[model samples]
Target: MSALTGTTRLARLVLRRDRIRLAIWILGTPLLGYALAGSVASIYPGQEARLGYATTSASSLVARAFNGPIHGTDLGAVVVAETYVTLALIVALLSTFAVTRHTRQNEETGRAELLGANVVGRYAPLTAALLVIVAANTLAAVLLAVALAGAGLPLAGSVAAAAAIGGVGVAFTAIAAVTAQLSVTARGANALAAATVGLAFVLRAAGDVLGEQSADGTRVRSAWPSWISPLGWGNQVRAFDGERWWVLALPVALLLVGVALAYALAERRDQGAGLIAPRRGPATAAPRLLSPAGLAWRMQRGTLLGWAVGVAVLGFSMGIAGDEFNDMIDANPAAAEAINAMGGGADLINAYLAAMLGLFALTIGAYVVQALLRVRGDEADGVLEAALATAVSRTRWLGTQVLAATLGAVALLLVAGVTTGLGYGIVTGDPLGQAVELGGAALLRLPALLVIAGVVTAIFGLLPRWSVVLSWTALLVFLLLGQLGAVLELPQAALNVSPYTHVPAVPAVDPAALPLVVLAAVAAALLAVGVAAFRHRDVPS
Candidate 1:
């Protein structure tokens, strides 16, 4: 049989299996662009306002680092600038997860071996996965273009913007295809791809921040670093301005090179093996392996460290940008009102910090869910059964996992708070005072984070099979509600459903002890119910 004998059939299978998940990424990603376009149009309705934004943002290194270089002062160009970096990053992740889910995940679970016993060929799975992901990216591009135009952006700019977003996604899809062949397991493949994406963003951001700006402060010619990254190429497309269609050739070239490399690597590796083999563990178990808590910590420490670094970077960026943002807000009342809605205080700087901190809470919520879901991963892998055969009780094993997750969450928050304060303090020459204040404000978010942990645990206990999908979905819903509830003008009842809504917007509003107490009680109750339910459920193995 040919190496790609079953590519078509396998592609169909991938779509059938991942329809809902793919649908969410495809539809939801573009929806964010649509929302941002509408919000930007409303905020900067006039040419003068757009120019003001261009001038202020162009001169601010922090703004340029976050948003990339400004293309033009037009409404369409502004929308592209606002949404491209974030949307491209999102869709890039979408591609990675999709590729790894179909390729490495199938191999890890032995489904690939089972299929290979039949009519499937050697290269069929990889080819099929790539085909499906490419198709999905194409569909996402079309939808994003339509969404942008529907939001009243120019058609040409909208198409350019969508192509950039989709180009980044496709480029990353190829990267993931290669990473899948390099890693032994799906998790490793995803982590490698994610790290690559992070590097791309940093490169793009660095290039933009270091680039020279025009005399009018409306355009920047990015440095060489931007030219090397796919994200940078996407940005260089200059959507809604001159629209450099040739810039897109860069990603297309990378995609071709990456695909060829992935196929070559695949041929070198044995089935179910990787080009980069996992290191051998010591012959003996460490003493820490004896305890459930220790094992839990060992399992989760790496993820915690990764997230801690992410939040620290976030906090530092926010801190450095705080004072400048206050001035920006003062200059733009419409933007100020939106920022204030997150959690405004008498001090505009404090308000900005509070709003950013609240956003961080949503981000940390994702980590919380992922950490807690380690329990589900263990259960799915049938490792729980082996561990349970020893002296460990179900409750202890599960509770230890929860404890690890909680402590990790706390550490992440503390790190964020301290780093934010540190960055601001370094700028203001009052590090200690700012660290204490921002650190405290960051800790104030703990109750809301705990609620998310409880929710994930509950889902794992009650619906083991659905735990992964449901847990992430729950987090996404909470995130949307927390970030956009006010912007969307949803009802008070709907907003209150998100635990983040109940948390005091620290520094912006005074902390209320009662609400904190109530949230804690709710979290405790959920944890108890989840633990109790998990104790009664059958181990799926």
Candidate 2:
């Protein structure tokens, strides 16, 4: 058989392994697009309202940088410009991670070694992964097209929009295939791919912002910087405006080039190894590594640092944007109602900051859960058994993981608060107090965040097999209720399911001590129950 043979069989294997993930990516992307479209349709129902939104969005440097360059005055065009970049980013990131994980990560973990000993060809795994990602992207495109068209968008525009979004996934999947060859570890490969995606976003934002003429008193050109990023290229496709189909050619061409380079590099490297190998550590273990908590800290510290940095960046950016937000509200009367609806008045900026922090806290909660679950994962992988055979007790082992989760979440929230405060202080010229206050506000949400981690732990202890799904399901429900319940006209009881709802919107509104205390109490109870159950149950065989 040829070196490239059995690609089809490998593709089937990839699909089997990633069935749930593929379903989530394929279905989630378009569903989110449809929901956003529905939201826009509701929020700006009239042409005049849509035009005003378009005008404001186009005028705002931050908005354009985050979204894409506005193409036309039409409502459809406005929606396309506002929503496409975000959707494309999600799709691209998913595809890139999917490809990298299945290809390089599997190989690194030794799963590919067993497969390779079979009929699998040299390039079969990579090719299969690409095919699976491509298929998933295509499904997303089809679903998006149908969803948009069902929502009464012009069929041609819908098709174009879907294609543009899918094209982004295809492009990034190929890029990740290349990165996979270069990086030695799965984490490094994933990071490289994610960084590339972030760079593309930044470049696209720069190009869009620089190329546009400032609608306000400033003189900024908006379209030039967008030309720099693949995301920009996708947006420039302008799904609704006169259909610039050729814009897709850029991503497609780059994908092909990336695949070729990755293939060549793959051939040059040894199986199960990257061009770069991990650096060796000291022969003796550090004194800190000897402790259960220290080992947990070592394993989770890098992830916590990364999360903290991301939250800080987000917080800082939102803070800087606060001034712009106020300026925009002052400049546009139409936006006043929308701003008021989001959070009332001159303090709206603070409200926005609080809401952003709350949402990020949810993500940090997920991070904490995953970190804690690393202990469960270790047990499943037999790593915990070996450790337990050593000097560690069940209490000490589990306590280390839980402590890491709890502490990590708190650290992340503090980072976000401090970053926001610093940025707000810089803009408003009150550096010291804002940072302190915002940081305090961020801390108030900790009870709710911890409650989420506790819930995950309880599930992990009581129903280990279903823990991850249950945890994520709870998060999804909470997110849906907190974010969309009002728009969807859901009931108050339903909205209250999210612990976030109880945490008073800080900075804008005074912190409500009652809810914070209640959440903390519930968190403590859940943790106790989880630990008790864990003590009683036998570790899984």
Q: Estimate, for each residue in 144-216, the C-alpha lDDT of model 1 and write its tens digit.
A: 9999999998899899999999999899999999999999999999999999999999999999999999987
The TM-score of candidate 2 is: 0.91
**Per-model lDDT:** 0.87, 0.79
Model 2: ten consecutive residues of lowest lDDT: 213-222
Off by over 4 Å in 1: none
Give the least accurate 10-residue stretch of model 1, judged by summed lDDT. Answer: 326-335
How many pairs of residues collide in each model? 0, 14
- Writing each residue's lDDT as its tens digit, candidate 2 over 451-470 gives 88788888888988767667
Cα-lDDT of candidate 2: 0.79
Q: Candidate 2: misplaced stretches above 4 Å?
A: 214-225, 330-347, 463-466, 536-541
Q: How much is the lDDT of residue 291 in candidate 1?
A: 99
